[model samples]
Target chain A: MDKLIEAIARSGNPSVVGLDPTPALIPSQLMPTPGKDQNTAGTQPAHVDDGDDADRARSLADAYLRFNRAVMEGVQGIVPAVKPQIAMYEALGQEGVRAYIRSCALAQEMGFSVIGDIKRGDIGSTASAYASHLSGVPGGRGSSPWHEDAITVNPYLGSDGITPFAQAAEASDTDLFVLVRTSNPSSGEIQELKTEDGRAVYECVADLVSEWGRESIGEHGYSRLGAVVGATHPQAGRSLRARMPHTFFLIPGYGAQGGSAQDVAAMFDDHASGALVNSSRGIIGAWRTSEGYSPDMSVEEACDTVSQCARAAAISMRDTLLAALDAR
Target chain B: MDKLIEAIARSGNPSVVGLDPTPALIPSQLMPTPGKDQNTAGTQPAHVDDGDDADRARSLADAYLRFNRAVMEGVQGIVPAVKPQIAMYEALGQEGVRAYIRSCALAQEMGFSVIGDIKRGDIGSTASAYASHLSGVPGGRGSSPWHEDAITVNPYLGSDGITPFAQAAEASDTDLFVLVRTSNPSSGEIQELKTEDGRAVYECVADLVSEWGRESIGEHGYSRLGAVVGATHPQAGRSLRARMPHTFFLIPGYGAQGGSAQDVAAMFDDHASGALVNSSRGIIGAWRTSEGYSPDMSVEEACDTVSQCARAAAISMRDTLLAALDAR
Candidate 1:
């Protein structure tokens, strides 16, 4: 986690580009051509397809893999980390899952830490299995294919569910970001409810996160265990930062989710070392809606244009977040 | 959900076999051989490996698929439904995901309602994507390969996250089970906390679940949207059952998890409807440790023995639950 914070400092940016690849954002050239051997260099099943559901799903997943690889390459030096939202790839079925694993591996190979935004939560053995899947088990056989530097987890099941993940993260020397105050509109319905103790539900969760991370504090005075505090709720973000000083923050709901740099600046500390802001569609899908990029571009030209837009958008996001931190 | 209730009545049992297959539980004969072609039938990637991580993952996933198929076949008539815990399969990577999809399909084909215990939750678009992945979008493209009759979802993200699942359930005439009072020992850490309004957090969630199911009531007078109230929390389960009369309950934590039939009986209605108890290791892994099942048995003999044990265990569980409900 200190390494992650140091990387952020080295780049002078607290932002992580979210590689959430959707088919619409992928260039046509990247889509697997129909009739081309679909089984080319991966563990793809050998089911015969006739341009139906299987074929379409396989092609879509292929496109996602290509787009993610390109995006990682484009934003390599500018971004310290990448958070891949697993739900987007999971929508395409098994082929999509393959793409997700590949994307994470590609990002890790490129010197960028990957935060798998799975938001998985369960109880006991099931929870332990999830923890081991993301963070490899100690002295266990074979390497985990879906290894991530950190992973997002849901806290609905309480301590028993979260303890396994905490243990796994400690053993693997990785990190965890538990959901506290989410950025969604309806998050307030549960997270904002006041407890009998006069604290909101998210506040209670934040306190526990601080406790869980206490033993895992890095050299920078931040723990490997962190909280997912939405950028959309700037006031809550500020209070949570004060309440959980030793815990880092994975700030989401930025840019297209309606969170601005100024809104999320409160998540950081005096030196801007306690948080990582995320921007998904705003950066990767910028080519589709940005001013200079047009639909008339050829496949090859569109791929190049999208890659350039992604790099430029990353730089712009980094500058905006840095400026906000400076102002703070 | 009405169909689920009717199935329970027909089977004279309110139990579902949780098909959470692990490598250790699978017999050696069913395991995928190292040299055999793994991509002969499904959409397996063509990545060549030297029997390392990828090969081990693939073989383990194959064994899980075979084990799950046998368990479903063995318990087909006795159990009203089967809940496939996605985490167990997901631990094996992409090949594991494919196995999960196939296992669900096999159970559905065997005339059993498949509850994909994914426990997935996210906000807005991501939530909608998960719903669509489990339950195919209406009239959109080819059939969804990972389609299930119902899915388990987490509710930490609140109403916005659950609304999409509710909408999907209504659209597809499927069902949903939202996490309420989980069976884990530490569930009370958050769920039992008193709110400012003098209601327990789980109680508030119960009210929301009841409301979410109002618009999706089935012919049996039960809602397609249900709640996952742990069987281990008998008192809480009883209270929740009374509070959410219209909503069905998917009760987990039985047998190996320390939830006796008596403890879970409160979740059922007078006719033993409105709920389905889940027993994973108790039934599926019975052959491994139970008497009269030995390692010397051939693969064919072992598979047969395991299937027989599963059927017998399902029957025993059914009778125990019926007696408990009768006593209640």
Candidate 2:
């Protein structure tokens, strides 16, 4: 948490780039031309010549890596962290996961904290296994396969599931963000259910998240255990800020998710260092509508367009959030 | 649901061998000898000669695949299904994931339904991406990388996270099990939080799961959306069984987790067609205590011991469960 906080302070940007890649978000020029090797992303609906399923996955994974590298290059120094959503990689099966690790390793090399948006949760022993993402493989001599500085954990299974991750994060000097209130529309169906004590389920979970991180508060007045409060839930985010003061916030659901920069202003502490807003499609997909992008451009030219557009979008986001905080 | 119910009926066993392998659960005799290619399991604390992290994961994944294949062979005919908890494989990284898919494919080849215990959940597009486990990769010509007949999902994100999985399962003629009442000790943290409506959170989730699966009821009078009600919660299981009439159950926490046959009896339907009880370490690790097992034995002999002991333990589990249901 200290490392992340220091990075955020150094950049003076409380925002993270969500490196969540999808075929639709990638430039058409970057996709492989048809009738070529089945190991590249193609515009022809990823039709594999051979009936090899693994090849299809490998092709798409390769394209995702290209797009991610472009995006990572785009926002290298502007953003303190980049979160790669594992779902996108897992979609391509193991090959995509390999790309995800490469992306994380690249981000780390470029001096950015890598948050693996895995959201994995299970009971006791299994949770310990999932915590390996933070702890690295047992006796691997400090070789972490999944190079993540932090990860998002699901709290549905409660303390037994979360403790292992928290312990691992502490052991590795990494951090974890527990889902308190999600950005999705249907999230309220469970997270907002009013409890017997008149508190929403998210409130109870928020308290638990705060308590879980109580013992690990770093020098920056923030704990390694953080709460993921969506920007869509601005009122909830505002209340949670006061509620879990010691816990930092991973605020997702800005831009494309209907959350505005103003909506996230209250999520920060007085110093504006208690939260890091995330925007996936908003930042990574910025090249989608960029005027500089042309279908006739070569892969190298298209990649340049993507990198420039992403950097511009990320800078705009940081400025907007900072302005919102200043106005507040 | 129809396919799974029929398989269970064919075997007359409401049990699924849980293919969850750990370093401790795997026989040491089957582990690779020290100072080999460093591409296999070894008793030497997995000390890699070089600093190659990938090699470390590959070795552990190899051991897991071997253990899983042996266990699959042992339970092939007796059990209708096998649920491989993904957390164990994921601990070793992407190589572990490859092994996981191979294990699932092998189990399917052996005429067993593979249930992937991947409790994955996220919002809309992300959930859709994760649904690739059921629905094959786009334009792969029906090539499904994750060869599981069914997969588990978390319900904390509500219906938005579940609808894609349900739709994909329906499209692929597969099924999904949503977490309802988990078997963990601290499961009650948020699950049992009494809502203003007087129903616990899990009960609400149970109702939602029932409604979500209402349109997908199969020939066996069960829906594609199943509930993961832990065997540890006997009372809750009994109530949920009556509550979710059309939804099937994937009961975990049996055997090694302290769930007894009597505890899981009420989870079944009147015809014993509604649930599949899972026991992982209990059956897979049975060789550890068997008289036939000896560290001095060859790999073939050790695997044979694992097979026979796993088969014997799975049979005992099936018989105990049947007797409990008959008494009930």
| lDDT of candidate 1 at residue A302, scale 0 to 100 | 70
Model 1 alpha-carbon miss at residue A155, Å: 0.7
Poorest stretch of ten by lDDT in candidate 1 chain B = B36-45
Which lDDT tens digits does candidate 2 get at residues B27-99?
8865544444344434334433324556767887898898888888888899999999998888888788889
lDDT: worst 10-residue window of model 2 chain B: B41-50
Instruction: Residues A51-165, candidate 2: write the lDDT tens digits.
Output: 4557767877888888888998999889999999998888777788888988898888889999999999999999998998988775455456788999999999999999999
Cα lDDT tens digits for candidate 1, A1-328: 7888888878777889988876566765666564433333243345423235566677777778777876777788999999999888777777778889888888888999889999999997899878866554212342566858889999888888988888888866788999999999999888888999999988988988888788899899999889999989999999998999999999999999999999999788887779999999988987877676666776667767778889999999999988888898
Candidate 2: clashing pairs of residues: none
DockQ of 2: 0.52
Q: Which candidate leads the pack in lDDT?
A: 2
lDDT of 2: 0.88
Which ranges of candidate 2 are over 4 A from the true structure? Answer: A35-52, B32-52
Q: In TM-score terms, which candidate is top?
A: 2
For residues B1-328, what per-residue lDDT tens digits would candidate 1 score against the true structure? 8777877777777889998887667776776554434333243344423235567677777778778877877888888899999888877777778889988878877889889999999988889778766544212242556758889998889999999888877766688999999999988888888899999888988898888789888788899889999988999998888899898999999999899988888788766778899999989988887676776777767777889889989999989988888898
Error of 2 at B28 (Å): 0.9
